[model samples]
Target: MSTRTDTTSQAGARAPGQREPTAPGFERLDAEYVLPLRWSEYRTGDVLELTDYLVRIAPNLDVTVVDGSPDDIFAAHHQLWADLVRHVKPDGEATANGKVAGVMTGIRLARHRAVILADDDVRYDRPSLERMVAELHDADLVRPQNYFTELPWHARWDTARSLINRAVASDYPGTMGINRDLVLELGGYDGDVLFENLELMRTIQAAHGRERRVDDLFVGRVPPRAAHFGRQRVRQAYDDFAQPARLVLELSLLPLLAWSIRRPLRLAGVAALAAALAEVGRRRAGGSRVFPATSALWAPAWLLERAVCVWVAVGSRMLGGAKYGDARLKTAAHSVPALRRKLTRADGRPGRGRRSTTSRPR
Candidate 1:
């Protein structure tokens, strides 16, 4: 484990003290694969992935950035991560990237004993790696939680999905304290990168026969207010009614309530009513009462976004294409299979984009 030290300078620089990184202890295995992102440009609503990367890992550690200013539209750099990992030398100890890139970076860089895969939007109070190092003592994996500054509606959706994933979706051994090596042993993230973090956690549990653990420092913050509200409509549209079950079980009644009106009007009325109720429920559930009017206006847009996502999801799968973010989705697109195979290879095979695997930690 690393040791922490607190140091304050006369110039008003306060470096929170932490255990000195056991870089020396792990010196024999000191190297790590690092990825940092600075995007070229993206639409206002599309930069969360990049923002998430900057906020999460930049303060605590150095990163490896791609040379040019990359655009932020997800597809532009979707496979860029896979290309970057192949450039990492085997002597490197670990690797990490943000959003899709970070996961791929870590998997490709896993030649040594330790690898850290993290969400880049989170901020650690101190140098982040120490927690992973200490937990690495007997644990196979370590992951952190998403700590939000002000919970946005989109963040709430993510929270719901994450909670469901952790609390009830599935079970695996040693899942409480997730680790990189354990993830490798489980055949890597299998492409659908959306839930790789959970996948890694599950993989660790399966390999080490224990649950993954959480640390005190793993915290995340919400996006900036401008970004939050500006993009809120799009995210809500994409998320809120995307699932049939959520629509049928949770929101279906709204349209029925407003049915006599025109279709758009009915949907609008239902959306407004539902948003109000959800706000009330949120307050009742011990959340803040600070609801924004923009949130109400955006609710209907999410209905449209949800419809599009559902259509896309269904179409993609039906046409032998997996959902956009899953590994199998890549399989349907010929370019991804070769890259995926390269990104997930073990045994030092020089395959581009193949990932390396780790043994089960005893």
Candidate 2:
């Protein structure tokens, strides 16, 4: 039960806490949650939760981490990715894929039959991974849905924001597994896109491949810090650039609300109905209970914030900004490099001046 042992095997077999590597020949039939890991000083409870999940799901691989550092005993799987230049808020433009770019790039190069990308933010059980892999049997790409867990007061304020997102946008799960070859054919994900997963799926569909959302099985992500969550209203609004359909839906909400304001009863009815739909979505987005009915109080705030943020995003685009996140909000018209090439093929890990190391935060 404790994964705190100091010793580990020389051959890079998994330890109690470390995740098992992808099976040889890249022929794994089951889907696993792939975490492209960076080092962490995890709390005991967090570590224990992660440990239990890994141990209980051994071989089944509820989760897998792509380690950049060589400290872990199970470091061989770290070799799966070529060192690219990874960085947390890199200097040039933080346009690169957030966490899993390296893993996705590695899969592209290894020509792996399949790989799944999962970030450390989410809270989920092992069965969710099984559902995703099962979905992949018939589709080229599969994404799960996510809801916020741990409704810190700030998260409750943003609850409606997330709900509106679920209603209008195609849910880009906190994790996804896809065929490497398909990614290669689509030229990989557009690294600079604010919504890389959506961009990835859009490219896949453009190529005439099958893609689907496994909605019944859900996952959860850490609630954003209050400050970050506020900025996220605008930042993610900018991300909708990739999902035009959602973008249009979001845009329509403003005018609908404006009209509803002229009729208080009608406005209240619509708001209440939408909030109920949001709660329904939350229920379906499988995860432990956390949302408060009172959280729905923030739905109006979510609507107003999205409306204003969409304008901010559009204004930045008009000003020629490239991508958005971390509130950099800079404007640059130059194009970024291919997502695959960003992860350079050197030393099985990154070489200096190529890319920086990954930083683990929400």
Candidate 3:
């Protein structure tokens, strides 16, 4: 093994304990790798320490923690792409480095067929990287399901508001290994690569003409840096949970409008009134005959709850914006392109490949 770093080598080499054996006249499937970063709340000087920790823990995974100010780095060393994020800026903008930044770097240096865009805050255990890499044989993309590591009180409140976001993910169909070509083929977040999970799923679904797949490739638990009550304290932007709105819109409104003429409001109204009258009559009869005791009281509560649910459904149908996020980045979907250019500039670009020698170890 040799001790050197460069764009090509850093991105392409295996970790300390890992071996990079290639058949004669054939290059290994390993591609260039990168971790885009722009720390917020966490101190700047702590970055090197963080990278050092990563190297120590998984030296096989070469990481460069690039600083936003100093553009200079060893051309041979693994590059750590960096950017500046401010509290004043929107949350999404502040953390927009990984998608475009890391993706772009991988595109530049990787010898492997695939380039992975990973997050810095995520903790990858010993088997994690290998598993994700292995997934490439079947699919183009591999998005690991992430568990919450830390959180704030407000964040917990936000999470609780959404009914569908309780678990790591909803009970959907088969695991999808989203192909990279599917994403690139679709031009992936063309205007803004600062995408959330749902956006990624939608993109995959759109390109492949099928929903995104799920798998158990990467299983990450809460790291020590994460909060003890991580699930409750974690706060995500409103835009991150896009499913709620889409689900509500599709389930509530589109069907109503499409079928309005056939059923008609008048017909629905008459049916509802009839149902209500029937319900009241049954309750009255049960109060006097069947239950004769609890029905006089329990029936009212049951009816009220049912009525409220129906009312909410009607309103949800009328309103388009039904889903909510802990924090919302209320910008036009159209505004992504303009924002993407700015983020790409902030992330900067990687240089050409560099070569370095490793120790001639057995």
lDDT of all the models against the reference?
0.38, 0.53, 0.35
Q: Quick one: ranking by TM-score, best first?
A: 2, 1, 3
Higher-ranked by TM-score: 1 or 3: 1
Runs in model 1 deviating more than 4 A are 1-112, 127-129, 150-178, 183-187, 192-194, 205-209, 213-218, 222-312, 319-362
Would you list the rank order by lDDT, best first?
A: 2, 1, 3
Write the residue-wise lDDT of candidate 2 on 1-362 in tens digits.
22423222321233244444334453434544456544333344443444444443444443345443334423322222112111121122223444435455345434234556766566555456556666666667776666676778777766666555555444556677676666665455555545555566654554445666665456767775578676666667877665567679888877888888999997898778777767664554442254556665677666677877887788877776534434343321112222223323322222122232211111
> How many backbone clashes does every candidate have?
56, 4, 28
TM values, all candidates: 0.43, 0.64, 0.43
Q: Give the poorly placed runs of model 3, Cα more than 4 Å off.
A: 1-32, 40-45, 56-102, 148-185, 191-194, 209-215, 221-237, 244-362
Instruction: Point out the worst 10-residue segment of candidate 3 by lDDT.
Output: 82-91
N/CA/C clash count, model 3 = 28
Residue 355 in model 2: lDDT? 30
lDDT of 1 at 56: 35
Please name the candidate that would achieve the greatest TM-score relative to the true structure: 2
lDDT of 1: 0.38
Candidate 2 has its poorest 10 consecutive residues by lDDT at 81-90
